[model samples]
Target: MDTVLTTRHLTKDFGRLRAVDDLSFEVKRGQVFGLLGPNGSGKTTTLGMLMGVVNPTVGEFSWFGEIPNHHVRKKIGAVLEHPIFYPYLTGQKNLELNAMIKQCPEENIPGVLELVELADRRNDKYKTYSLGMKQRLAIASALLNEPTVLILDEPTNGLDPMGIAEIRELIKKIAANGKTIILASHLLDEVQKVCSHFAILKKGRLVHVGPVDDVGKGAETVEVKADLPDFTEVLMQFPGTASILPENGVFLVTLREDFHSKDLNAFLIERGVVANHLVTKRKSLEKVFLEILSEPR
Candidate 1:
């Protein structure tokens, strides 16, 4: 399927509070999609509705262009929160039990274990496994069915640096293998690092949606410092120079629409004004997110 999932004006309400408001987006096949929002922004609630655990108060959604139901859910594997397993059971034993419950073949066990890099520790007790290993085991359980799409809600939540790194690499590995992934995270850096496309939600409302690489496009400000005596005058005369301000002996130039840092540099050179320093400062995802949230809805 070209489209893995689609939500149409999906919304949820708990009494008077709207958990998710008019949410609509599409996840394409083979794309690592990220649902980004802060705590209490209805990310978990949205996932719950999509997974059939919580019913939506308004709107609808579909999986593979079919109505979502148990059968459709079977094609999608997910880990919504912390994973649970028998602490006393060995990793191998836990997966074996999971496979039995999932009705998947026992032969799928070894391959999933190897995929998560937990093969060597398969014999270790679940309680003895480190947090990262436990998380990986949880992901392995989700993958036991060989699902078409995998949904992870804060897969790296509460993880230390090492544990987060482990999950990060594992996610990249999974996405590389042609699985459509829907990842919900509050960590901006992680989303920027792994998600090919993303939707930003604030106060349960989708504020922005686009490819991750397009985050700071057309929003960059260039900082220029020239050795010439008329540096400020030269900068102001350049085409597309929207505004220029002196900051600590450097000029911060905001470019107009359709203008960029390269154009500015070329203009300076043509005018016989050589710059000693020029740096284009792109807005980070975090900065862009805050700006999005602060805008009027």
Candidate 2:
């Protein structure tokens, strides 16, 4: 796959604070790349610089191998922070204005509105639309130019569960059409479901970046649940094991790489402990994110 976006040691500072420090990553064409982190962890700042809304204090980045100039930025569509629109303007009118500004054909307005499922509501004033409707309209404005790369920051914010689901499905459909997507969000489950690749940021630093599956590989700890009160004492005998915590009458054991699920159950049975429920924890992107964020900066 060809690289759609690339940044080398990208750094952004706000006065004495480093908003983004030495951030380096690549986003490929036709892939959904997730930029994940907690609030104030520089996810938004990095995206701002990428969109050319804010300049980096240090390092460099490129979109489609070209510097972030007007000529190149035209091919990229972005919705940064929140969807901003004139409150009195109708959705269709707002899109018309956006089309004029982007130099896109006026014929593309209705099609973009339809893509976002807001064609029926296009005549409604922006202030009268719900949060989800506003968000979808914002997306429609971004799609006016038929950009190859779509960058969204917290796209699902302020939407109800059903609204979120609608946006999620829309994004999946958009990806299926071969458009590259760059999503910066704190919603871990959304990222896990939609992104093929991800990068974790914390304290303005890039702590982890790789394929989504590899983020938490080999970290499948197991949870043993039994009526036995001496589970802690029994778990202590397992060598090469990390800490074990007791929760709701179950023992959640974090094992080292040397141990497996079979080894854990066998060791327990060998000691005459009846295991009621023994299941390996499925590692998720959220777990990997927390693990990285909890580490020292």
Q: For residues 1-297, could you state the per-residue lDDT of candidate 2 as single tens digits? A: 899999999999999999999998999999899999999999999988887888899999988888788767767788998999999999989988888777889999888888888999989899998888889998998888999999999999999999999999988988898999999999999999999899888878889888887765775588888677776877888884687987887778999887888998888788888788998888888877887888875
**Residue pairs with backbone atoms closer than 3 Å in model 2 (clashes):** none
Query: What would the C-alpha RMSD of candidate 2 be, to one decimal place?
Result: 2.8
Q: Name the 10 consecutive residues with the lowest summed lDDT in model 1.
A: 211-220
lDDT of 1: 0.90
Worst 10 residues of 2 by lDDT: 213-222
Which one is best on TM-score?
1
- The RMSD of every model to the true structure, in order and in angstroms, is 2.3, 2.8
Best by lDDT: 1
Estimated TM-score per prediction? 0.89, 0.86
